[model samples]
Each structure stands twice: as C-alpha cells, then as structure tokens.
Target: MAAEVKLAVRGAGKRYGEMDALKDCSLDVAPNSIVSIVGPSGCGKTTLLWSMSGLHGLTSGEVLLDGRRITGPHPDIGLVFQEANLLPWRNLMDNILFPFEVKHQKPDHGWIAHLLERVGLTGFEKNFPNELSGGMQQRASIVRALSLRPSVLLMDEPFGALDAFTREEMNQLVEEIWMETHTTIVFITHSIEEALFLSDKVVVLTPRPGRVLNTYEVPFERPRTMEIMAGKEVYDLTYRIKADIYGQSRMQARAAE
Candidate 1:
C-alpha cells in the first residue's frame, strides 16, 4: 500500500533581492515514497530543495513536516548533496557517524553497521573515502545521511557526478535502501529517465521564477529495471517531458529578444 503524506511545501516562495527564485511552489510528499523534481537549468530546483531542507527560509509560504512548520534545520530532515562530501581523512565508520557527533546525539553502532551492510560497504568500515570507488564513496555518504534516522531524505543531484555505469549501480542501491527503510525522499535531477525510474511522482518545474509545470504519477511496478526504459510508455513520457522543457526554453528566449 502507498504511504500517507509526511512532508509538504505550501505556496512556498523564495526571493533574492528583486529576483524570485521560486514562486508559489507547493508539493505534498508521502511517507516512504520517492518524489523526483526535474527542470531546466536555473529553474530553482536546488533553491526549492534548500527551502524544503530549512537551510534557507522561504520569503513566502511554508514547509511542513508532520504538520508543523519548518523554521530551520530539524533532526528529522537529512540532506545529501551533489558531491559525496565525505571527509577525506575520516574512515567509513567515522564519516557515517559524523552526523550524530554534530547533533550531539548518541551514536547507534548497530544501526550504522546495518546501513553499511545494506549499502555493500560492510567490511570497508576502516577505509577512507579516498580508498573507496566513486560508487562506494556515494554509498558511504548515503549511509551518513541515513545515520540520522531522518523521516525524510533530501538529495540534490547525488549521482550527477558519476559515470553512466556507476550512476545506474547507485540507482539500484538507492532503490534497495528506499524499499527497506521506507524513508520519504525528495530528489532533484536533470534526467527525465532518472526521475521516472526512481519516483512515485515526478514534478516538472518551469524556468526561473520557478513553478510546477506538471506532476506525473509513475505507473510502473516496483523492482524496476533498465529494460523498462525501452518500453513504449516510458518512451512517450520521456519525449513529452523533453518537448515540454524545450518548448518552454524557446518561449523564454523569444521573450528575452
């Protein structure tokens, strides 16, 4: 069964001086479900995430978690950035436990071990980020985020830096962990295929002064594979989204001339 709504952004807007980065943006995210946000470059995808994370407050509207307002960073929200951002000097174990240390919360070794095993970094606890492969480093970074045991995970282009092959592997890993942990996730990406593959719902945003263009409910069953990308339904959806984004880009250019 699908989960209940756990996070929401209601009429959220953020402005930088005279520029509006996000305007009247709102979304309801379900518990234990994955939502992907996609948009053209400079469309405030990252800005929306920053607002949701409570790293920056919205100039208008609100972000809610469990029905309460998000005034700032909370323990229940965990963020993973585009880079793995692991400390080069810290070993896998130490790096994963870093969040707890900063939060002044007691480290849960058992939970940490479980996450390491789940992400396939079980025996490499002693290895530094430099000692791990790109995929492995990312896995460790995920473990670090999960260590907080946050109800929601916000990921911003987490795999955008990896090669195509490694990115696919990381996708599979994320799928496995999401299923196991039932954590709500809001992921931002430029790839429509990635959005389709990883999301329960996909939100496409318009160009700057960003607003929702459309939201799609992904219909494919779980345990999804790369082969699903080749299906006619997936192809049609991909084509339509690309056309929508391209169409908007041209419109914006024409207006600027």
Candidate 2:
C-alpha cells in the first residue's frame, strides 16, 4: 500500500490580480520522503511552496497536513529560502536558536549542537554570519529552520545561490538531513539533475499558470550517491523531463499565437 500522505495540496490555485499563477496543482508528500518541484522560470514554484507553508493563501483550493487544513503558518512547518538570510550580528548558535525564542520555548542546546555538527557548523558557533563562507552561512540558515524540528520543511531553491561544487555538497547535506530526521521536504528548484539527485519523486510543472506536467518516481535506492546521477537512467529521465517542459512551452506559445 502507498504510504500515508503527510502533506496534501488539493486542487490548489492562485491568482495575482488577472494573472493566474497556478491552477489545479495538487500533490501529496509522503512522510519522510523528499519531493522536488521543477519547472520553467516563473512557473510559480515558489508561490506553490508558500501556499503549502500557509504563508500564501490559495484562491481555489487548500493545503492540508495530517488532514488538517492550513489556513496560516503552522508550528509543524519550517521554511528555508535561496539566501541564507542570517542576521549578520547574531552569530551561528544564536541564529539557530532564534526560532525557539520566537515561539517562547526554551532552546534545546543538545539538538542545536547536534544539528550544527551535522551541517559542518560545529566549531563556528561563535562566528558571525559575515565570518562564514557563503556555503557555511547557508548551512547555518538551514540549521535555523530545522531547529524547531518541524514535521515538514519547505525549501525554495535553498542552494541556488551557491557555487556548483558547494551546491552539490549542500544537496548531499539535504539528503542526509532528511534521512536522519525523516522530515518531509518539498524542495523547489529549476535544476532537473539536482531535483533528481535529491528527491524520492521529481515533479515537473507547466509554464505560467503552473500545473503538474508529470511526476517521476526516482528508482534509485537510498542512501543515494552522486554515481547514480552519472547513470544512463538519470540521463534518460532528464531528457524526458526536459521534453515534457519544452513540449508544453511550445504548445502554450502556439495557443498564444
């Protein structure tokens, strides 16, 4: 039997004035699974991510967690965006513990320290955001989001600002975090290969007024390695995903003409 859906987007749609950003985009995320969203530029991937996080409301549908409708931000969800967005003055440990202070909860030093080490930020606790490298700052941002131990994490191209080598390292770190915490993640990115590398399922969306074009269940078993990305199957799936996106783009253009 299929696993229980930890997060569900039911016929979700969003309209910005006359612009329809998304339409009937529904998806299910299984517990402990990594699901990646990919599509052409401006296909509303980030909008959908926000909708799931309950930060943005849908015009037509609803998002649910454990079958409960999300009308606004829930304690069980956390967000990480492209930039580290850390406060320059806070220092690593303080930044990671900021979430606890927001909710008026006491900080969990043990968990924070463990997450810091997992993301390779252990010794940098005393360092300010500027003291860290780009990748290190991003890692600190991730640890901050995960600090609350939310059941679901929404990542909007969290590593898009990093260099290629650092991006790959961060991707591996994302997988490791999911494997360790079993936190269901909905990652948004434009890179097909990166999506395939890190997701249990890679979901492709159509151009403007984004809708689900296709979903590919990655056949590779975990713990996944970069070597899987070099295989023929990866190339084949990549080709198919591109074809789906490009083919839809062409059809949309013709309709406009």
Candidate 3:
C-alpha cells in the first residue's frame, strides 16, 4: 500500500580526469514524485544526471532503480536533454518513434498519438523539426521521451534553452503530464523559480565537485497555478533557496583564497 522507492543514488561520485564532478552525492526518488536538482552553473548537475541514466560510469558508489543496479543505459529510463535533438530528416512521428525503431520494436501507435495530442503536436506529425518553432520542437522531444512510458524520467535542463514564456508553458505542461502518468521524475535546472514551481522536492548542490547542500520540500498544493507563485510562502521559500546557493558559492570562494 505504500509508495515504492523508484530510484536511488548511494554515495555516488563522478570524476573526469583530474576534475571531480560530484562527491558523496546521495538521493532517493519515490515513485510518482518529482525531484528537481538546482545549483549554479558548472556545479556538476548534468554529471549527476548522466550517472543516474548510466550514460557515465561513476567513480564510486551506485545508482539503483527498483532495487537493481543500473549498470548501463536501461530501457525503462527516459532522458530529455537541453537540446530537442530531433533528427532533422525525420518527421515528428518518426522522430518520436525513433527509439522504438532503434530497438527493432514496434511502437504503440495509440499511445504515441495520445502523447502527441497531450504535448499539442497533434497534426504536426508529418512536419520536420526545422519546420517547427523551438518550443514546438522541444514539446515533440518531451513526447518522444514519454511515449516509451519510462518508469523514471530524467530531464537535464529540458526547457533551459527556450524563451521565458515558452519555458513557463513547458513547465506547466510537465506538471500536467506528471499528474496524468504518475511517472517519477528527476529534473535538473539552474532556475530557482522553475525548481520551486515543478518540484515536490528540490535538492540544492554546491559548486565544482557538487555535493548536496540541502533538500527543500515544496509545500505548494498541486494542480499548481501561476498565481500560486505570487504568494508570500512561495517567495519566502525561493528566497531561502537563493540564499543557500549563493552562500555556498561564497564559502567555496573563501576556501580557494
């Protein structure tokens, strides 16, 4: 009857050559919950995501999904990166189905169609990536990630490249999709507002060799509205997180000098 522990990182660490990207990082994600990772630029947020997705091997510790070790890129996990990364030659439908094609499997047309509609790309199936706006293309990429019904969705700055309005729209769309599907999500971003708006739990990280500085629970009720962000509670929490992140930067600078 209890919610399951969907994904976990235990004593996880990553390094590239002489540079340590993450150190002693650990977190747990519950099924059907959304967790956001936030930090300043170059804080190893992407490295953490790569480790979770098994795209990069960790220097220490482990990433577990459903009690099993994630040794490599598992099929049950879906990832959406900063760029839409759609195939220029393939139309929307084909691009969305590209994952299935690569695995020599047939895609579920019914579900694919439904996802297209959910992401507002219903009639644009035949259109190429170049033919669509940046926001539309990103939506298609998101739908593609979700079309596979991944048990865990890993998004690394998926909307970071979009304009302000588009980013906010996509944030709402993400919330809608998460509510509908109940899929576990680990979203990484640099924006405090984005983290506060979309996360059930926001994990703050330190700079360079990133470490968990704090984890804040977002108490805002869902089916969240834009107006909710204007409340005193929301502003206070955002300010707190902003202070924690900036404070860490100052500490790091002091240690360096």
Candidate closest to the true structure, highest TM-score: 3
Estimate the TM-score of every prediction.
Answer: 0.95, 0.96, 0.96
lDDT of 2 by residue, 1-257 (tens): 97699999999999999999999999999888899999999999999999999997999999999999999999999999779999887988888888887889998889988999899888999999998899999999999999888999999998888899999899889988988998999999988988999898999998889899899998798777767888899999999999998998898899999
Model 3 over residues 195-243: C-alpha lDDT tens digits? 9899999999888788898999897888888689888888989989999
Q: Is candidate 2 or candidate 3 better by lDDT?
A: 3
Number of the predicted model whose lDDT against the real structure is largest: 3
Error of 1 at 128 (Å): 2.0
TM-score of the candidate numbered 2? Answer: 0.96
Ranking, TM-score, top scorer first: 3, 2, 1
Cα lDDT of all candidates, in order? 0.90, 0.91, 0.92
Which stretch of 10 consecutive residues in model 3 shows the poorest summed lDDT? 219-228
lDDT of 2: 0.91
